[model samples]
Target chain A: MPSGALLFQSVLLGILLGGLYALLASGLTLYFGIMRVVMIAHSAFLILAAYLGWWLHERAGLDPLLAMLGTVPLFFGAGVLLQRVLLTRLRPATLTMMSVLLTFAIALLIEGLLGYAFTGTQRRVQLGYGSASLEVFGARVAVVKLIAFGLAVVALGTLYVLMKRTRFGWALRATIQHRDAARLLGIDTDRVAGYGFGIGLATAAIGGTALSLDTTIYPSLHWHWIGPLMAIIVVGGLGSVPGAAIAAMVLGMAQSLLQIPMGTTWAQTVFYVALFATLAIRPQGFFGGRLAQRF
Target chain B: MPSGSKVLKLAAVALLAVAVLAFPSIAPNPYILSAGVLVVYYAVLATSWNFVGGFTGYISLGHGALAGLGAYSTGILVAKAGLPPFLALAAAGAFVGLLAVPIGLAALRVRGASFVIVSISLVLILLLVFQSWSSVTGGSRGLVVPRPFQLTRPEHHRIFYFLFAGLLALAVLAWWLIDRSRFGLGLKSIREDEDKAEALGTATYAYKLIVFVVSAVFTALAGGLYALWFGDLDPVFQFSILTGSYLVLMALLGGVRQLFGPVVGALIVGIALEFFKVEYGDTPLHLVATGLLLALVVLFMPDGVLPAIADLIKRFGRSDRTSIREVSAAELREQRLQNAGGTK
Candidate 1:
C-alpha cells in the first residue's frame, strides 16, 4: 500500500473534484426536475463553455474565472431559446423518452461545431500559479484545485439560496415537486420550464470555467464526462439538487481514493460501477421518492 | 390480399434481393463496392439492434459494445487460437450473445432515462476495461487480425459484401418470424407497458432478456465479420458511443417499428454518411450534418421515414381507410366542431 500521506492528500483532491462535478450535475438535475429532459447535451455545453473560457482567456486576455461572468447569462439565454424553439413542441406523453434522442442530436451538433472551430487538440487554461502548490499534513496540494474548489463552494452556495430562499426559486422548486399541480394552481409551467432549463444550463458556465483550469479539455472530451455525470445524477435521485451535490462529492472521493489501488484508468470504473449498482439496488436514488420520477 | 398485388409485392421483393446479391458484379469501381459493403454491414447491425430496441421500446445506446466484443473475440480467436476466421465469427457471436445475459439482468431492471444511462454506462465500462487490459486487447496500440481471405482487396470487399448481405437476409427472416409470432406479441406488450404485460401473463423479463441476447448475437456477427474483413481491431472504434448512437439513429430514422425500417435507415444514413466523409475529408462536417438530419427526423418524422411516408400515402391515396386513432386529437376536435356547425 502507498503511504498515508498520499491517501490523505487524495481525499482532499477528490472532494475538490467532486465539487467540480457537482457544478455540472446540478444543471442536469435542474433540467430533469422541470422538463424531464435527460439533457445529454449538458456535457457538450460544459465543454463548449470551457472552450469559450479558453477563447476569452486567449483572445481577450480575460481570466478563465472572470470569463464566467459573461458566459453564464449567454448559456442561460441559449438554454431558454432551446426550450422555446425545439423542446417545448414535444408531446408531454413522450418527453422523457424523446428528449434523449433530441438532446443526443443537440450534443452531436455542439460537439461537431466545437470540433469544427477548435479541432480535436487538447487545451488547458494556463495560469501563473498553475504549478504552485502548498504543503499540508506532509502532502502537497495544487493552488488551482483550491481556487476551483472555492469557486464551486461559492457557486453552489448561491445556487442553494436561489433554489430555497427566493420567490422565483420557490416557483422553480414547486414545479420540480409537482409540475401539473403547480400549473393547476396558476403557475405558468411553460415559462418556469424555460427559466429552469436556463438556470440549469447556466451552471455549466461555472463548471466549464473551473474544469478548464483543472484539466486539459478537447472538443471530444465531453464523451468521457457523460458517463460519470449520468452516474452522479442517477445516484443523486434524478431531480434532487442536494442529492446530486452529495453524490458528486461521495463518488468523487471514492474515485480519488481508488486511484491509489486501482490506478487512474481502472479507477475511472467507479462511476460506471456505481451507476449500475445504484440502478439495480435503488433506482429511485437517494432523494428520488416520488419527486425524482416524472411519470 | 388481392392475388395480383400480392404477386407484385413478392416479385418486387425478389427483384430487390437479386439486385442486392448482384451488386458486387455491377458496381463501377471497388470504392463503390466497398461502400455497398459498409451499407449492408450497417443493415445487419441496425437490424440486430432493432430486435430488442424496436420490439421492447428500450433504446440501447450500447449495441456498439456488443458488436465490438464480437469483433474483439474474433480477433483473439483468430490471432491467439488459430481458429478459422469463419468459425470464429459464429462462436464470437454466440459468446457475446451469452454475455448479454448478465448485462440484460442488470440493465433491464430500470426503465426510461435510467435504462439509457445504464446502457451507456455499460459501454463506457467496457471501453475502460479493454483500454486498460492491454495484454488481452492490445489497448491503444490496437490488435492486428490477420486477413483470413487470400484474395485481392476488391475481391475481399466483394466477398464480405455478399457475406453481410446474407446475414442481413437471415436477420430480416428472423425478424419477420418474430413479428408474426406469439413471442412477438409478448415483446410488444412489454414494449407498450411492462407492468401491464406481466399482469396479463407475459414473461416480460424473460422476453426482454431473450431478445436482448438475440440482438447481441447478430450485432456481434456483423462486428466479427468486419473485424476479420478489415484486418484490424481498435477498441476505441469498436466501443464508441458514436457508433452506438449511429445504430440507434439508423434504426429510428428508418422506422424501428416496421420490418424494413432498419434496412431503409441503414441504406440512407450509411450511404449519406459515406458520401459526406468522402467529400468533406473528415472535418466533423459529417457529424454536423448527421446531427442536423437526426434533429429534423426527430422533429418532423418522429414515427420514422417509413411510417411517416406510409401515413402520408394513407392520407392522400386512401383517406377512407385511415384509422380513427391515427387522427390527431386536435383534428378530431375540429371535426366535431364542424359537424356541430353543420347541424346548426
Candidate 2:
C-alpha cells in the first residue's frame, strides 16, 4: 500500500487538476444548457486558446494570465460569431442532432487550422517555476499546479458571480430551462443563446491558459480532453454547473488515485467507465434537468 | 412499370460496377491498385456505418473502435490461438457483432447528442484498453499481422482488392435487402420519430439493436481485412477517430437514404483523401479540407451530394414537360388556329 502522505499528495494534485477540468467543462455545460448544442468543438477552441496564450507568452514575453486579457474577449467574439452565423440557421427540430455533426466539423476545422499555424508538435507554456515544488504537511505540491488551481478557482468564482448577480444570467437560465418558454416570456432567447455561447467559450480561454501551466498543448490535444469533458458534464447532469464542478473533482481525484496503483494509461479508462455508468444508471445525471426525448 | 429515373439509376450502378472491376486489371502499377483497395475498404466501412447512421439516424463517431476490435480479434486469434488468418477474420466479425449487443443497448438508450457522446467514448475506451493491454495487444507498439498468402506485391494487392470488393458487394447487397425489408421501414420510422414509432407498436429498440450489431459486424470485417492486408495492427491507427469521422463523412456525402450513397461517397472521399496525403506530406491541411467539406455538406446538402445532384437532374429533365400552365393563351390560340388550318 502507498503511504498516507503520498495518498494525500495525489488527492491534492487531483483536486488541483480537477479545478482545471471544471473550468473547461463550465463552457460545455453552458452551451448544452442554454441551446442544447453539444459543442464537440469546445475542446478545440480551448486548445486554440492555449496556443494563443502560449504564443503570446513565447513571443511577447507576457504572462499567460495576462494573455487571457486578450484571448478571453477574442474567443468570446469568435464564439458569438460562430453561434450566430453557422448555428442559428439550424431549426430547433434538428438542433440537438445536427449540432453534434456541425460542431464536430468545426472542431476538425479548428484543429487543422491550429496544426497549420503551429505544426503538430507538442508544446507547454513555459512557466519559470514549472519544476518547483512546495512541501506542505509531508506532501509535495508542484508550484505550477497550485497556480493552475488558483486560476481555476478565480475564473469559476467570477463565473459564479456573473451567473448569480447579473440580469443576463436570468435570461441565460431561462433559455437553458426552455427556449420556447423563455421566448414566450419576452426574453430574447436567441440573443441569450448567442451571449451564453460566448461566455462558455470565454471560460475556455481561462481554462486553456491554466491547463498550459502543467499540460502540453497541441492541435489534436482536444481528442484527449473532449471525452473527459463530455463525461464530466454528463455525470454532473449534462448542464448543471455545480454538478459538473463536483463531478470533475471527484473523477479527477479518482483518476489520480487509480494512477498510483495502475499505470497512467490504465487511469484514463476511469472517465469512460464513469461516463458509461452514469448514462446507464442515471442519464439525467446527478443534477441534470429532465431528459429530452431527442434523436 | 419502371420509371425513367429508375432505369437511369440501374445504368449508373452497372457503370459503377464495370469501372470498379476494370481498375485492378488496367492499373499501371501496384500503387494504384493498392489505392483501389483503400477505396473499397472505405466503401465497405461507410456502407456498414450507413446501416445505423443512414437508416436509424444515430451518428456514431466511434465506429473505428469496432473495426479496431475486429483487427485485434483477428490478430490475437491468428497469433495466439494459431487460427488461420481467414478463419480468424470470420471469428473476429462474429465477436465484434456479439460485443455490439450490450454496447448498443447501453448507448441506444440515449438518442441524439448523447448517443454521439456515448459512441465516441466507446471508441476512446477501446483505444485506451488496447493501448494498456500490453500482454495481448502489445500496447501502443502494436502487433504484426502475419500475411497468410505467399504472392508477389501486385498479386497480393489484386487478391485483397478483389476480396475487399467482394465484401463490398456482399455488404451492399445486404444493405439493399435490409433497405427493402419491413425491418428497414420500421427503422426509418424510428429515425423519423422513435416515440411515435414505439407508440405505434414498432419494436424500435429491437430494430436499432439488430441494425447496430449488423453494422458492427461489417465494420469489423472491413477492419480485419485491412489489418491482414496492411500486415500491422496498432491502437492509434486502428481506433483512429479521424477514420471514424471519414466513415460518417462518406456516408453523408453520398446521400444516406440512397442505396449507392456510401459507395459513391467512399469513392469520392477516398480518392480525395489519397490526393491530400500525396500532396501534403503530412501537414493536416487535408483535414481542414474535409472539415470545410463536412460543414458545407451539413449546411447546404444534408441529404448528400447524390440526392442534391439527382434533384437537379430531375428538375432539368422535366422542365419542358412539367406543366400545361406554362403555355400562354396566345400560344394556345395559335396552336388551335394552326390545327384548324391544317385540318382545312
Candidate 3:
C-alpha cells in the first residue's frame, strides 16, 4: 500500500543503518572467527568508545571523528591485554563457557563503571551537520548518517585489506583455519590472537564513534545494541566476515521495510524474528561454517 | 560415601530448611521480613533457572521474560478478568509453561554460543513487545496487581515470606527429584555431550523441552507471587536482563552441579545486594560489586566457591592421613625388629 518513493526511502535508511551495524558486528565476528570467543562485551566496548568520544569532544573541543585518534588505540590495547592476560589462561575444556562469562562480566563492569561516572544520563555528540539532510531520490537523507556510512565502509575496507593482504592477516587466517597446523608452521598465534582481538576492538571504536554522531547513548545502552549486533553476526554465520556484512544489511533493510507497514516500534522485532528463523531453518547460518560447538 | 555421613548430610539439610522456614518469626521488623521474601524469590528463580541452565547446559538468558510473562499473565487475569489472585497465579504458571514449548522448540535447536544468542534475543524481543503493547501490558505506566488478601502490613509481609518460602521449597524439591531421576541423567548426558547422548538412545530433545517448560512454569509462579506481594508491576522490572544475569550468576557462584548450589548462591547474592542497597542507598555500586564477584568466580573458581571449599577440605584431609600413614609404617618396622630380637 505504500508508494514506491516511500519504499525506496526506507530501503535507503535501512542500508545506512545496516552499514553502522556492520561496523559494530565486524569486530564481534572477527573475534569469534579467530579466538573462538563470542565477545559478548563487543557492544560494551562500542559504548565505551562512544563515551570516550563524547568526553573528548566536551573536554578538548575535538571533533568526534578526531576523538577516535585517542579512543581507538586505547580500546585496541585493552583488547590485546584482555586476550593475553585473561582469555589465554582459560582451560581449554571450559574456554567457551568461561569466555562467555568473562565477557558478560566485563560488560557489566563497563556498564557499572559508566553508570558510576555518568549516572545513567543519555548523552549524544552534537555536531554541526547533525540536523542537516541532503536530498536523494526525493528522500531526505541525514548528513550525519551518510558520514557514518562512509566511515563504516572505510573501516570495513581497511579490515578487508588487513585480513587479506598482510602477513599478520595470513597468520590470523591460518590460526582460525587450523590452529595446530598454524602453530606447527611457527606462527606466533598468541601474538596473532592478541592483534586480532585488538583489530576487532578497533573496529568497535570506529563503529561507536560513528554511532555517537546520531544516537543517544547511555551506560546500559549496550544491552540494546548487543542483542541486535549478535543477531546480525549469527544470521550471517558466526565467524564469516562477508556473511556478517551481508546479514547486517539484510537485517537493516528488513527492519526499515517493516517500518512501512508495522510502524517504527514493531519494526524492531525484525531482528530477533530473523535470528530465530535463521537458527530454526539453518543453525549453521547463511554462510554455513563450523557452528562454534566448542561450548 | 558412608551411611552415617549420608544421614548427617540429610539432617543438616533438614535443619537448614527449618531455619529458613522459621526466619520470619525472629525478624526484627517488617523491613527484614520483606528482605527475607526477596531472598526466597531469588532462590526460586535461581533454582528454576538451574533446571535448564545447570542441568541441560543450555544457558537461557531470557528466563526473566518467562517470569515477566507470568507476572503479566496473573496481573491481567486478576485485574481485567476479575479472577481470584491465587487462582490467577496457578493459571499464570501454566500459561507460561505452555508458552515455553514453542519458544524452546525454536531456541533449543541451536547449541552452545548460538543457543545463548537466541535465548538473549528472546528476552529482548519480549521486553520490546511488552513495552509497546500498552493496551494489554499497560505500556510504561504498568499495571497494579491486586493483593489476594487484606491484612496488616506486618502480617502481609509475613504471609508472603511463607508463601515464597513454600515455592522455594517446591523448586528445591523438584530439583532434588530431577537430580536422581533417569530423565535427569539424560539431561546431564546432553550437558556432557549431546551427540553421544543421542547416539546412546536418549531422547535429549524431549527431556530438554520438558525441563525447560517446567523451569518456565516455576519461574512464572515466582513472578506472579512477586507481583502479588508488591501490588504493582512494571514491564522493565519484571522482565529485566539484570534478573537473568543474577540467576546465571547465582547458579554458577554456588556450584552449578551441586544440590544446594542455587540456594546458597541466591542467599549470598541476595543478602549482599540488599546490604549494598541499604548502605549505598540508590547507586550503581551494587552492580559493580556484583560484576566483580561474577568475574572473580568465573576466573578463579569456575567450579564455584562451594566446590572449591570442598576440594580444599579434601586436600587437607589427604595430607593429614598421609602423615599418619608414614608414622604407622615406621612404627611397624620397629615392632618387627623387636620381635626378631625376642626370637634370638
| Residue pairs whose backbone atoms clash in candidate 1 | none
- Models sorted by lDDT, best on top: 2, 1, 3
Best by DockQ: 1
List candidate 2 segments past 4 Å from native. Answer: A292-295, B319-344
DockQ of each candidate's interface versus the true one?
A: 0.58, 0.38, 0.41
What are the RMSDs of all candidates, in order?
A: 2.8, 7.2, 7.2
The list of candidate 1 runs beyond 4 A from truth reads A291-295, B1-8, B320-344
Instruction: Please compute and give the TM-score of the first chain of candidate 3 against the native first chain.
Output: 0.97
| Local distance difference test, each candidate | 0.86, 0.87, 0.86
Model 3 agreement with the true structure over A115-175: per-residue lDDT tens digits: 9998899898888878999999898899999999999999999999988999988999998
A-chain TM-score in candidate 1? 0.96
Error of 2 at A55 (Å): 0.7
- Better TM-score candidate (2, 3): 2
Q: Candidate 2's error at B116, in angstroms?
A: 0.7
Angstrom error of the Cα, residue A263, model 3: value is 2.8
For candidate 2, what is the DockQ? 0.38
Poorest lDDT segment (10 consecutive residues) of candidate 3 chain A: A286-295
Per-candidate fnat, comma-separated? 0.56, 0.59, 0.58
TM-score of 3: 0.93
